[model samples]
Target: MRILQQMNAFCVMTLIAFSISASVQAESPAPVQAAKKALAVGQTAKDFQLLSVGGELSGEVKLSDVNADGKVVVVVLRGFPGKQCPACSAQVGDFVKNASKFAAKNAKVLLVYPGPKSQLDQRADEFLQGTKLPAPLTFLLDPGYTFTNAYGLRWDAPRETAYPTTLVLDESGKIQFVKISETHRGRSSAAEVLEAL
Candidate 1:
């Protein structure tokens, strides 16, 4: 009888151990390396259509449509991350300040604002309250990190959003230049982007 009881207890313990392991696996997300490969310079850029929550281009913006027009595209922005990011503001400001220069090169700049799906539009609108986007430079919404994940730029950390990413795509949707900042401090400057163009 004692041996029988010991066997049952061992079975229970094994079940408990399996349950704990399963719970841990369920709670942990896949490592960043497991994500889709990020786009590289010279690769054909993936086309995405995200909503224009705010800015000069306030509607659905399609990347393919822009590429078809023989225009270069510059996409780089840290989407809303529970609040306005100062670095993002500065990066976007630089682009907005150079909007005329981008237009002169027939380039369209798309600044992506990514965040959770809940209240995303409201947050995007709030983020744009004080800024003005000129022609050929627009703000886009990446609700629930859809675009961020698709582009392999989701930061996926506590209080973090997408990685600060800059891509310059040629008229054929090929990436002419790309910069994926490992940290918030290395964002590509407007001048560098123009030079890439």
Candidate 2:
């Protein structure tokens, strides 16, 4: 009878231990995803397709198409956060003013406007109002942050859109220069980007 009682207690303890182990396993959180690396110079530029809600190119714009014919590609702009950014406006204006210079170098400039999914196209159009993008300078819309996330530039903060970035790509689609602004200030000027090209 004593042996039987000992065996029962041992079985009960074993079951409790197993239960605790299972509970711990269930409560443990899943492993976190690794952080995505930011795009940099010397790396091959990742190809992305985005709609041109407004500008010279009012259609789908692909990186491959931009790099076709050995044209240098320049990406310059900030994604719209809560509203249109004055800094972005100034930066784009600078690029537009220098559109002729870009063309001279056989380069194409793409101004990326990123925002949430809600009325993204409408917002992009509103932003483009009163600003004329000449030939070789186009505006791109990043709806729902698809391109932003793919490039690891999603700001993901309140009242913050994507990180202001400028990338210069060579004819072969390799990144020649990359500037990712930590703050709204320090945007790449057209001359600086042209120098990279």
RMSD of each: 8.3, 10.7
Across residues 57-98, which tens digit of lDDT does each residue of candidate 1 receive?
778988898678766655556666666788888888888889
How do the residues 65-106 of candidate 2 rate in per-residue lDDT, one tens digit apiece?
Answer: 878856655554556677788999888888888989988898
Candidate 2 segments exceeding 4 Å error: 1-38, 74-76
Worst window of 10 by summed lDDT in candidate 1: 28-37
Q: Model 2 misses residue 162 by how many Å?
A: 0.4
Highest-scoring model, lDDT: 1
TM-score of each: 0.78, 0.78
Q: Where does model 1 exceed 4 Å of error? A: 1-37
Error of 2 at 100 (Å): 0.4
Report how far off residue 156 is in candidate 1 (Å): 0.7
Q: Model 1 reaches what TM-score against the true structure?
A: 0.78
The lDDT of each candidate is 0.78, 0.77
Q: Clash pairs of candidate 2? A: none
